[model samples]
Target: TGLTPWLAWVRGQAPPRRDFNPCGAYRFVRHPVYLSFMGLVWFTPTMTLDQAVLTGVWTVYLFVGSWLKDRRLEHFIGEPYREYERRVPGYPLMLVGPLATKRT
Candidate 1:
């Protein structure tokens, strides 16, 4: 809804193309959008096997998709995305601490 306009604005202002997928979960999860959405949904008090499975599926997809996108962005956007990733939490959880810290 409101995001469409904001996304358009961002796209307009984004740097010149350096080749990107523009399809991965990076913008939502690596960026603030999906992280905020997850926070809002986390406390919902409903649970069902089907809903749980669907959530799991989407979560897995987001993780895998983000990994691939990171590889591309690391080559394109370079160090900035890597640095931002370290500072900001991933969508579902804050992957912090020594174990989670990315190694070059």
Candidate 2:
């Protein structure tokens, strides 16, 4: 449901949406892509020393980048984003219940 709107927004054809997203995987966590990337980094069956180092660096970058992105969104969207922040966890570890629960 959201992919098209997101793609449109990314293309600069639309403004940042004022609506809150609490559906699908977004209901479980705010940053699913970052979580997926982290999972890929840590859950690999085999990793060389260099891969481990790279994973660590990427993990750090993800955390920092997500923080920066969140701040930017909050600044751009203001109260709506702040309310969403209160309702949704930014990290997967912070998830509290089933992924489909739409808690507004």
User: Which is the leading candidate under lDDT?
Assistant: 2
Best by TM-score: 2
Where is model 1 more than 4 Å wrong at Cα? Answer: 1-29, 40-42, 86-99
lDDT of 2 by residue, 16-102 (tens): 455655688877677889899999999999999999999999998987887788888879778777777777778855554322222
Q: Write the per-residue lDDT of candidate 1 for residues 23-65, one digit (tens) a residue.
A: 3565434545544544444545896888777777766665666
User: Model 1 — TM-score against the truth?
Assistant: 0.50
| Stretches of model 2 off by over 4 angstroms after superposition | 1-18, 94-104
| Per-candidate TM-score against the hidden true structure | 0.50, 0.70
Candidate 2: minimum summed lDDT over ten consecutive residues — where?
A: 94-103
